[model samples]
Target: MDRARKDMIVKEILYWKDNRMLPEHYCDYLLALYTEGNRPKDKARKAKGFYFLNIILLLLIPLSLLFIYFTELSFILQMGLLIFFTITGVSLAIYFTNKGIAPQLPLAVSALILLLISVEMASHFFPHHNTALYGALMLNCLLWIAAAWKFRQHYFGISGLVGLIIIVISIFI
Candidate 1:
């Protein structure tokens, strides 16, 4: 590819990642066959779960903003969140490269938690912005349900219940 075309492709990939793109067969591949090198290692170990969870968080970008909207968080708390996400994101990326992600990846788990909390806050506190609110609610709900069904209780089944509640309320609201 020409220099310009190559640059465009690189930019597209970056955009897709920023948007948290998930593959269709991502869940399906969890069980079909095991890749020998896919397991986690140690301090150098990389958890695949954390890796993919980070991707899913891309979709949560809007929802995270919703969190900032409703919650009466202190400036420190907000800054803390920013730092925590950045650190965890970078750590998980390293793990992804090292194949240290043995079983459950921490990033995926964190995303599920973040999604649930954000959805709940949006549902309970934010009373307006039907479009943005509903979109976050529905998206989080579906993702939660899918994650629960695929990973089972291992990924925190509580999120499934939360998603169900959000979906019902979304329908009514």
Candidate 2:
């Protein structure tokens, strides 16, 4: 309402947030206020959280999921995929953990595209070894499931379905 009222409100929020005594909803409220210039510090903290969360989601989650899809150790074909995801995920996490880095969405998407290619490459590697192929496919399905849950991305949901189909087809083919 007035400057004094606003200052008091802001101070109370800071006290609650700093003390960790506030509910997550309160943090959300602060985040909204901060985003709207209601409070500067809270906005900064919210932005920091988002920056790191992007790292975790765009890079971390996928990397962590695909890490299990190891095909060849020597050629490093599948391990390559694992490494690709791990590196990008870790890099993003590092890049934005402390401060916002004005993340390049294109780079992240490009890395993801490569990661997808790696999965296809891995699948092709063990065509004869149905056991390995199917097991890896199952892992892929679960990974997509997690992705779908976290991101609500239709691609993930579809990818998960494809993984299931691939696993089933491998048994017959």
State candidate 2's TM-score. Answer: 0.38
Judge candidate 1 at residue 34 and give its lDDT: 35
lDDT of 2 by residue, 29-80 (tens): 8756744554454577767877666655566445444544442344455556
Once fitted onto the true fold, the runs of candidate 2 whose alpha carbons sit more than 4 angstroms away are 1-85, 89-128
What is the C-alpha local distance difference test score of each model? 0.53, 0.59
TM-score of 1: 0.34
Best by TM-score: 2
Mark the regions of model 1 whose C-alpha exceeds 4 Å error after superposition.
1-105, 112-127, 146-158
